[model samples]
Target chain A: MKLTRTGVFTIVVALAFLAVPYAATLLGSNYVITLATRVAIYAIVAVSLDMLVGRSNLVSFGHAAYFGLGGYAVAISAFHLANDVPIFGWAGTNEALIAWPLAMFVAGFGALIIGALSLRTAGVYFIMITLAFAQMLFFLFVALKYYGGDDGLSLSTRNLFAGNRITDARTFYWICLAALAICLLLSWRILNSRFGMVLRGAAASERRMAALGFPVYRYRLAAFVIAGMMAGLAGALWANQNRFVSPDMLSWVRSGEFLVMVIMGGLSSLVGPVVGAAAFLLIESYLSGWTEHWQMVFGPFVLLVAVFAPRGLWGALRGKGDV
Target chain B: MQLVLEQLLNGLQLSLTLFLLAAGLTLVFGIMGVINLAHGSLYMIGAYAGAWAAAKTGTFWLALPAGLAAAALVGAAMELLVVRRLYAREHLSQVLATFGLILFFNGFIAWSAGRSPLLMETPPQLSGFVEILPGLPYPAYRLAMMGVGVAVALGLWYMISRTRIGMLIRAGSDKREMVEALGVDIAKLFTLVFALGALLAGLAGVMVGPIRSVQVGMGEQVLITTFVVIVVGGIGSIRGAFAGALLIGMCDTLGRAFVPMLLKSWLSGPLADGLGGALSSVIIYLVMALVLIVRPRGLFPVSG
Candidate 1:
């Protein structure tokens, strides 16, 4: 594992992520730490999505359904826990550890239902259906008047851990860093496990894998659930960081932004999604400072890459070596 | 009942608008094999251009063709500049690239025209309603939309199904190699088809301007519905697109109008309203899901 390129790369990146926060404290680079924090969250989501998108070759347009649902779970949970409302009378925890896992469950469950129906579709139909499912979820959230609806929900405070002050910046950063590490490790293990091997073979050649006795559909659904859990993790962190959860988190546009991160960073490569998320956030932050309509400039530029450099950022950097 | 008749007319009007968008979208998918998520952006552009023109000249007639032309021209340029290069990429790349176009276009329009809906006045000739039944009447503009939509559909059918060029499109869908073997300029045919599709989308946008206010990001809401229609109708199938468009239009409108009323009759009013509103919005998607379950290739898949 240590010798493998992905493993080595992961270690180096993880070290940098750790070193950056400490360095931020030393050098007073809170901005950089904050930026890295966002990158870490987005990367978790992107890597999880790669499980389905890259490993299984299931292009989902509704991955945001989990993301938005995860945020809602945290928000709604906080609402109930703070008000001392029971889960139909059972006490709820206001802590993120419990809330985070619960959010993951809700997100994963939703993905399970959507993927079951959508995975049955392939090619163009598959794309549109997945997209439509995501949009449907988006609309549902938008239409709900109970929890901020279109306006969104804002938490009074970040979710607390059992004994730790999660409100502390450096502490929160380390906690996020640990979560990211666990997520990446889990993703890598899943891809290399026996299950992972079968999944990849199915992606490369679904028909051949089926003929060889693999239940391709189940693997794809499992991958989708895995991906949804990852996105839910991000959404949970995002809610804590921003203390807000809105339909915007689950929009098709936001989903598209994730796709951009995956592509610009390098699709099919584990490190690519992380790198892409970092670069995208950094660039967009800088560009938006210069002009309000930076998207007009940036949009075509990204399109140029998609059109001309289909290999994406990672692909362009490593060439055939990465693939 | 007059309510049913009126809803049918509204549905027909809506169907024509959808047909325009769907026809262009499905053709691009069928012939070029690229998912232009920004097809809606092109639709948006047409609306913007036409609205700008109508606002400037104070004449809806002149603005109509100007919008159509502007969209067609932009479509050609887009085909030449960006869309052409994306033909061989994976659908994800297409989705991303076009999505970028959406962001760009939305921002560009906002910067240039401000983020407000542009109001276009309807022409006097098309603004009146005529009595159809003893006590019921329909808006003339909606009737005109149905007429124009039917005419355009017929024109497209004739062009594709009855003309020499039509044979090329039929061949192009299934046997591009064969069409190229026949010494036809296949590249030109592609450009023509893309341009035609763009023109139709533009026509839809321009015609829709009179019905509602034109604004930024309007293309997005419509784009999804059009995609639904294409999926239900079967990509690359014109007749299927038409039928799917009408079915979707009717289901969407009637679902919105009557679902809550029906639900109220069965359940308590408040619960019915809450769930009904949500269910009404999902009616089209529900219809689509059922259709796909039965006919995965869509209701009227083009043989090609």
Candidate 2:
């Protein structure tokens, strides 16, 4: 493929993102580092969601179930590993590097199960069922008493990455940046692969895909699981960032927030999620200061965007959805 | 036996309320092919409107009709001003727009109502109990709700099935081109359908006000139930909505009511209580999963 103008522009934007934190570092501001870390984490989830919502045409309103499940896994595992207790004389490990894989597995597995059942139906049923299932998990977490329940569980500190490096803000931010960079690369690779084509085909014409002997359901379910696993990675970062995991992370509202990130960034583009994450967090930061009813203002803004500029911020800026 | 009867009555009452909510939702989806997430907001509007009116004048009856009217007005305005544009847009746009509306409505109402649950006291006329079939005492209001719901159901069936206008709606959903070719104005039909749908939802809200606390987010919870109802019943089918609503309402109410008792009989109190509450919450989803497995299109799928 030729190095097109849009591709170059994406590189420039990404470079800008990478340089901004360092630029802030030179200016002696730590706030940009935290914000950068958040953008990277949200980018991980947003990119994954794009596979389903943008390419596959599956509008899952319950993606938070996987994300929250992943967060809980890390939190629960860390607790057990720290406490070193077991009913059958088994102890959990506090090694988050090892625990990250476990979180991904749990989150991915949960999405696969939910998606397998939910993807059976289409249209309003699909959206509502996914939402219903997600809400079920949300309520389950709220009812679950042992691991913090409704109030959420907090870690004593952030997870360790080969010693105290994880505790350092700069080190942690770099790790998140690297992790997100790797995810973007992986997303690119997968999107260009045969599996990605199948997802796109299934999304574009499920019936045609079926007529052509392609098992559309498997492709979609695979995409859903993959997205869930990516969101799990984001969840791990969120837990480590705040050293907290709550039922709110798994709520329907969070799913809506995730969608907003995707929509604000531009649905069809890869880097749009990252850009969207930055804009949304910034908007959230300033809006919350304006009034307690920030949502009311934000809601109408979203409406205006939907009505007037359906292509979103990235799409509007780039002539050909070059995001 | 009496306890079982009461639970069944409770389930029936809940089902009646859900039927009213789902009827509008299914119709909009069927006729307009639009998913209105703010449908619940209309229910919330009805509740708050009625609550405010009833509180001011101490007249539940007056408040009920007025509340329904206000909700219908909001629904019609939504259809005309915002939702009309989304008719040809993608599901994503529709979702974003409707979701935005939900947030806007919640915040707007919260601003006005002060974020507290508004109390709706029962009217004097419908405050008593009615004994049915040997000491099975039930609230007259709930029984009246059931009666009203049944009457509405029958009225809807009569309109849609037996009337020419109803045939037009059915035709409009399945084949709009064909309906148009038959000399019917499809655009006008859509707006009318939307208004009617809102009216039903508003009535649902008004009926539900007396039983539940009228609050900002009450409709949001019930909306989830309505989704399950429409899904299990089959979109674009009123009969499907009725069956699914009653089925779901029964499962949810009975599950919540009986799970603890059933568990307590065989297990310890604390464990039973914990599992019971969790299990009850999941019952509707479980039922939906079961229905999807058996019939993906729903129990009473619409014929194209």
Clashes of 1: 0
Q: What is the alpha-carbon interface RMSD for each candidate? A: 1.3, 1.2
Every model's DockQ? 0.68, 0.64
- Expressed as tens digits, the lDDT of each residue in B90-197 for candidate 2 is 878888888888888888888778787878888889899999878787899999999999999999999999998899998889888889898898887888888888
The residue-by-residue lDDT of candidate 2 on A82-102, one tens digit each, is 777652565655567876888
- Superposed by TM-score, candidate 2 places the C-alpha of residue A172 at a distance from the truth, in angstroms, of 2.1
Off by over 4 Å in 2: A1-3, A26-29, A82-90, A321-323
Record all residue pairs in model 1 with backbone atoms less than 3 Å apart, i.e. clashing.
none
- In model 1, which runs have C-alpha deviations exceeding 4 angstroms? A1-11, A27-29, A83-93, B302-304
